[model samples]
Target: MLIMGEVHTGLLRNLGELSETECREVLRLTSGEEPRTWQRPLLYAISPDVLTGVDCRLPSSSGARIRGTGTVSHRATIVGGRVLQGSSYTTLLRSDSDQRLPWSHYLAAPGVVEVYGRPRWQDMADGFVTPEPPMDVLNVGAISGRLMGAVQDSARLDRKTPFKTTRTRLRWLFERDDARGDGRPAMRLTLGRDTMRTLRFTGEPTTDVVAFCEDLALHDWLLTTLQTLIQRALIGTAAPAQIAARLSPAIDHLLHLWMPGARVEEPFLPFWEELERHPGFTRQWTSSVARIRDQITVNTLSLLSVTESRREADGDPSPRRGVPQDRTQSHSHPVRRRIFFRADQRSRRRS
Candidate 1:
């Protein structure tokens, strides 16, 4: 089986975390249908699955236009009442008939795209992941963005976010173990500007591809958001206090949302484990978070030290209060930057 999907993840446009009730209301996409909610690990909810019809050209790496027709599944989610994601995917199944099927037939099998005519499936897969697929191609991301906008632009949300982070899109492909001739697992992860692509071949017989995709998207969003936040923070140039202030939003809303593979099925865990070993998504996230916390700690200590020094300066019973305080006598370091500045600079160099 072949499946290609896209997920768009972003910080829910809210000043702070939304209540469980509010999250439910915000994700209510279907009329009178309540969104699915769970409490374990953290507050999580998913809107009922919706279907979107697409009769468009499939992507072709060789520039050969292949036609595909069918429906794409879309759903919205709220994680920890802070992060929001819109996911859309289609399972590509070979159609025995070359003729177009009735609309009712396509509707019956929601989220399945039946490929028409003879075209290399590999070419189609390659085209989909290409940096720039042809304009007139099946774009799962574009479809996903609309659903994302629907929830994100909802009136229920105040659209007031603590940090200025935008949505990150993940485009991925997954194939079953039996489909491959050799039957060995395979995986590839690619990161670009505000976008990521994952290719996976799993030997396990599991039907949790959508869940896995969303999970990957959620964690990748956390990773991408922090990576971008640190860049804009000007770590080396910004003082410890300033940097900490810049990263406070992440600490408040995102740090607690780092539960990886929490909701994924047991069979697909190895793919995530492989990624952790190589590119190391969680590893980088942990390092960045540790540095942010360290900055906060240093900022707190620096403030207290300065406060104590000022108390001593003022407590001096001598006539020093009357005279102008010497700059050398100040307790606060003139160079306010902390150890993070050098560490960040060296990391940048290595990168």
Candidate 2:
């Protein structure tokens, strides 16, 4: 069995981090279903799972025609009351019959897509992981995006964010363990262009897998957003003041969000450790943050120096210069006195 999903991560549309109650209100995606909230490791809230009906072709790398019809499960979530995510997934299953079943049958088995014909698992996985799939293929990502859009458009949000950054998409596939208890889990993560990521893992599926993916997506977004901020700063090319201005948002909105695996289950920590070992996500983040702080310090000193120079040029009293002069001291001349007397005498004569 295969469970495929996608998560869309971005900054919440609010000036500052939201309160717990506000997060709940914002994430209430359905009418009767209440969103769940947790505050232990972090302030996290997720809406009730909703299903989207999908009837489309399942792409196969071997050019086999396979049709799948089912409902995709998805939900919206808020992390730290600052980051928003839309997560969606559907399990792939082989159908007992070749024809499409009634809507009731699909509704009964939520988040499970039944394939009409036999399809190679590897071929389907390859096709889905590909950068671009055919238009006719099943698209769980589109469902996730729509859910995110709905939440973003809600009246509960102020629609004002501290920074402007692109949202990241993470498409993941989880294949159930075939050996059951004997084999160890394995994971492979890949980065794609335009802030897209793909992860393929083979493991014993657990209830916390969705939450694990959400955590990964959130951190990935933080990394991507901070990198973009630094690049826009143009460090050596732009003025220190400009660079500092560009990096301020990252410092204010993103620096404290580097908690990798903070909300994931214990079993998933090894996967995060694996990522850190190779790409060293946290190491790069630390370096980027240090550079931002250093630049800000340099810019502060530069501004102070410029202010001091201006004061000196204007003859204002500097600590290095002599004592300040009193502006109240007056200089009187005979020509000024004569003109004042003449003006008074002329006014009196006219009256």
Candidate 3:
């Protein structure tokens, strides 16, 4: 069986992280289907799966016309009550009959798409990962996006995010691992344009694969967001103050969100470990955080120096640090009153 899916990841549309209870309410996608919650490594919640019906053309690498009809399973998830993700997937299989079946037949087998004609697995996978496909091709990503949008538009959210960032889409395909007898999974991740990603896995498909991909998508978003923050800082080109202001959002909202396998199951640990070994996700993240701190320190010292110089230039008494002065006790200068009287007399003469 060929499993295909997409995940959309983004910051929650709230000013601060939500509590566990609030997360449950926000993820309530449908009535009577309560969202599942977990609080071990982090506060996590997932909505019950929903189905989206699709009857469209299946993209093919060789441009073969193949029609598919079925429903896609979708769900919304919140990690750490901060990041929101919408995930959707369906299994592609060959139909026994060439003609389109009734809606009831597809509804009975949820998350399964039946292709009318025989199609090569590689060709279908290639078409999904391709940047542009035919207009009539099934779009699982769009289904996931709509689900995410519904959560963001919920009244439970205040729509006041601390930082402005874009959502990322990750498309994945999983097939049986024919080579390995040990049951270890092999995977490939590709970065694509416009904040899109593709993953191909050769392993036995399990129920946990969707959760693992969601976890992967969350971390990828954190990495991508922090990288964009640093790039916007423009360290040497922009002033220390400007750089600090540009990077402050990461410090306030994103730095603490670097946990890699926090919510992932045991079987997926190796995939996270392998990614760390190659690109060193944590290593790059640590370096970026340190750079932000260093720049903030410099910016702080510069601001203090400028303030001291201004006070000296004005010849004003240095205000006692951390001392709160009462407005009623403020002293009025006698010379300032005399100057005001003289100014008032000049205004009268001019009139």
Candidate 4:
């Protein structure tokens, strides 16, 4: 069996994060099926499943002109009421008949694409992660992008974003671990400029393929976005205040949203564990987050040092160096406990 899918992840172009009610109002894609909303580990909402039909040339590693017809399932999701993602995928198999089938026949099995000839599973899987896909091939990314556009163009959003960012594409392929045949799994991931490719070999019956891949895509995107933010901030090279200004939006929007494998199935736990053991997704995230916080702390200390220097130069009235501040300013500007928010404690240092 061969399965292929694509996901597009980005920050929703909205002025403020949507509330639970607002998320539901935006994700109501189908009439009868209510969008699933949850808040246990994270606050998120998933739109009802939507299907799209395709009768076109299937992608093949050997450049073979293989025709396929079936429906591709697509859906939209909102994470923490802030980020938006569109996912689309279709499984492939050989059909009973070699001849082309009617549209009704394909519609019967949603998200299953059948080839006219022998199902070239390897060719299809390889072609999907190819660097240069053909012009006349199955473009799952386009199908996902349209759904993303639909939500981005909705009236609920203000079409304004906190910071400039573009969506990323993650194309993934999965197949049975035939060579090993030992009920083990392995995965390979490649990162490109604004694009990614993931290929997996699994022996277990992975029931929640789409959901698990979507979770992986989400975490990958988080890592990618944080890398960009840090590079743009230029923390060590730039002025402390300047770096702090560049990283403010990250603290407000991105830092608190790094939950890996939050929605993965039990069968895929080994894959996640292996990934952590090597590339260390959580380790990279932890290091980057610590860098941002350290820069913010330096900025805070710089502000305080400058304030005290000015006070001593002006001979400001005060009890002593070790004395506590007056009660008026003490309660006004509270100290930042976690530094997740801006440090507005300059008032505490003022005369």
The candidate scoring highest on lDDT is 3
Q: When superposed on Cα atoms, how far off is each prediction in RMSD?
A: 6.7, 12.0, 9.1, 5.8
Clashes in model 2: which pairs? none
> Against the true structure, what is each candidate's TM-score?
0.86, 0.84, 0.82, 0.88
Candidate 4 ranges with C-alpha deviation above 4 Å: 179-185, 319-351
**Order of models, best TM-score first:** 4, 1, 2, 3
Weakest 10 consecutive residues, lDDT, candidate 4? 333-342
Q: What overall lDDT goes with each candidate model?
A: 0.79, 0.81, 0.82, 0.79
Residue-level lDDT tens digits of model 4 in 105-139: 98889988888877677777778888779988999
Tens digits of per-residue lDDT, candidate 3, 78-148, equal 88888899999998988887998889999999999998867677788778878788888989999999999
Question: lDDT score, residue 25, model 1?
Answer: 92
Candidate 4, overall lDDT?
0.79
lDDT of 2 by residue, 24-69 (tens): 9998778887899988677889999999898888867776777898
* lDDT by residue (tens digit), candidate 1, 246-278: 788878888899988999988879878988898
